[model samples]
Target: MQLSTAVERFLTAVQLEYGYSEHTLRAYQRDLAWFIDFAEETGARELADCDIELMRGWLWQRQQQGLAATTLARNVATLKSFGTWLERSRLVPGNPASRLRAPKAPRDLPRVLADEQMRRLLARVEGRGDAEHPESLRDHAVLELLYAAALRVSELCSLPITGLDAGARTVRVLGKGGKERVVPFGGPAARAIDTYLTVARPALIARAAQAASAASQSAASQSAGPQSARHDALFVGNRGGKLTPNAVYRLVARELEDEPGGGPRGPHTFRHTAATHLLNGGADLRVVQEMLGHSSLASTQVYTHVSTERLAQSYRQAHPRA
Candidate 1:
């Protein structure tokens, strides 16, 4: 089969059968397209033409173009998974990419804020501008929930109005692979979400809905489609649609723009902080795994490395004979 045809089929199978999210499908599509482009450049268009050498060459070409090792590793994984499927479907003589490998990507431990840092940051967030501004109220809740629940930005952005269990102080997150889980937060998160829902969210929703109505009439179509005048989305954007992941990133970045913690300033920083803090507070590894919505304990175990580094740092600073 043609390499491009194989990629399309693989995308369809993964999306329809395996229920991969749009984000994941798009990532695979992008990498596979890159590989197909490289293959075509080499005049090998058939899926059957892909062998270990061809696959490794493609990876090397990407490295020459300055791709990171992690990116190369992911491309390797995608290619192997695709090759396995091609074998299962009898389109290839064997899993040609089975022997392909990538450079070992360094496991950069996630950047985490200390307990004191988080407290100070949250205090600053709470006092940012007038607390009554609709956007300010929403920002406080977003940061609070992110730290409390260890939510990926996508999961947090896609939250529906019904996802919150206010009385229980828990959130129902639709995670990767479309899996759903209920994670509890602290009283602070609960309070922030409540304030947003009761006061700020409605205002932002109405403001955006009005703008959307006008824009829809002015233009026949738009990129994000015709947004409804109302929706059940928990976090509405300034444009009145659901809160987008990009907006979340900008919000968090701006909030922490001057933070001296010296690391990533996005939503995942909060996620990392939440996980590390949980581990530091003596929470069980499996429990932290479940909280982070990590499908594997290995994924959650990286925070343990972060915890160990912090412990060693503390020891060196405090020991008399260091």
Candidate 2:
């Protein structure tokens, strides 16, 4: 079969058979579209026509066009997956992109909060400075669990009330690919959550009294209360709807924007900072890997590079080898 036909079939299979989400399907489509354009520009025809030289030329074309390393990596991944699908479906004899190398992604160190900054961030989350504001207390719990659990923003936002085991200090998070893992946090996260559930959540429920006024209007109203208020949502918004991940991210970004010497804070910053802190405090790499819900130890190993850099700084400053 022709390369274009095979690519279409592969994408169809990914959508229908593999059950990939819309976002992933769109990404695959984009990557493959870029590859097809590259192939047309390079005068390549069939699947068998793609070789190491052709692949190298394609990468060079992208480089000359000034594609970022991240985009290049995604492009390579898309081609590789397409090649694999072609081979599996008997459209090609073998995978042509099996040996193709992608551009190396630029290494940027993960952002971490200094101990004092962490203290301040947590204090803000706990509403230590603004105890009367229900929103403040709720915000504190959200941020605390995010840092303490090393949860991806989506995972944190999707967290269910049943996932929390307060006595065990553990939370069961459903991560990428629907994989479930248990993550543990410390006393601060626990306390923050407890205060939100006890004090802030009820006030949020009360503020949503307008929602109650609609009770007699429909069956949806008769079923509404704080317990069943947000349809089992753990975090309720000011309007009594589920708090979205985007909203959570923006809230964190807003809080961090004002902090002294804190660089480019976002939702992921908490997870990165949490992982770095764990390694610094002598936690095992494998333990961190499991906590992070990483499929491979290699993915979790990046923080070791950060750890080594810190050690090197200490040796330079504190050692007398000179």
Candidate 3:
């Protein structure tokens, strides 16, 4: 069988049988597509021609090109899975990438804001939010919920209004791999979300409707086909469409631009901050794992490391002994 044909079949099987998420599917497709091209260029177009040395050469070529270790590791993992699938489906006699090893990607500690920094950030957002400015109100709620729930940006953007139990102060978040978990927030987040829903969301919806009506009446408007279907998403963009991850990234980056952080300034920083804060406040590791919707406890152990580092830093700053 052609290597490319086997890859397509493997992808289809994973998508349908394993229920891989869109992001994971895309990563697999990208990594495998590159491998297929490299294999063909090296005169290995058939599934039987692919071998461990060829796979190693592919990874070596990528390393020479200065790809990050994490990216190269993912490429190795993609090939391993593809090779295993090919062998299992009888397309190849054996798994060529069975012994392939991914490079040891450095596990950098996630960036987390200090307690004072978080307080100031929330206060600034709260000050900007008022009934007169709906977007500000939305922003306030967004920041509060992000910190309180430690939600991924995708989880937050895809959150449906019905998913929120305001009275219970709990949100039903659809996390990665379509796993659903209910995470609770504090009174401040509850109130901010409530205020946004009551004042901001309705106003934004009305504005969107008005804009659609106006655009329909204008002959030069290129977007005169039909108004977007009403969505139940908790968050909407300025244009009243479902809020995108890019918009959330911009919101978080702009807010954290001046804060004391060395790594990424994206919304996951809030997640790391929230996790570290929870661990700092003596929350159980298992509980934090459940709240963060991590399938493995190992994934949650990183926060413990962050908490320990923070403790040592504070001790160094405050202790009197040399």
Best candidate, lDDT: 3
| Alpha-carbon runs more than 4 Å astray in model 1 | 129-132, 212-226
lDDT of candidate 3 at residue 120, scale 0 to 100: 95
Worst 10 residues of 3 by lDDT: 220-229
How big is the RMSD of model 2?
A: 4.7
Span of 10 residues, lowest total lDDT, candidate 1: 220-229
Per-residue CA lDDT of model 3 for 58-151, tens digit only, reads 9999999999999999998898888888888887788889999999999999898999999999999899897877989999999999999999
A best-first ranking of the candidates according to their lDDT comes to: 3, 1, 2
- lDDT, candidate 1, equals 0.86
Q: TM-score of the candidate numbered 3?
A: 0.93
Please give the CA lDDT of all the candidate structures.
0.86, 0.80, 0.89
Give the per-residue lDDT digits (tens) of candidate 1, residues 235-318: 887667788999999988986776776778899999999999999999999999998888999999999999999999999999
| Ranking 1 against 2 by lDDT, winner | 1
- The candidate maximizing TM-score is 3
Across 180-252, the per-residue lDDT of candidate 2 in tens digits comes to 9999999988988898899988877777766566565776655754233546667877766677887887898
lDDT of model 2 at position 53: 71
- What's the distance in Å from true for residue 269, model 3? 0.4
Q: What is the lDDT of residue 110 in candidate 3?
A: 89
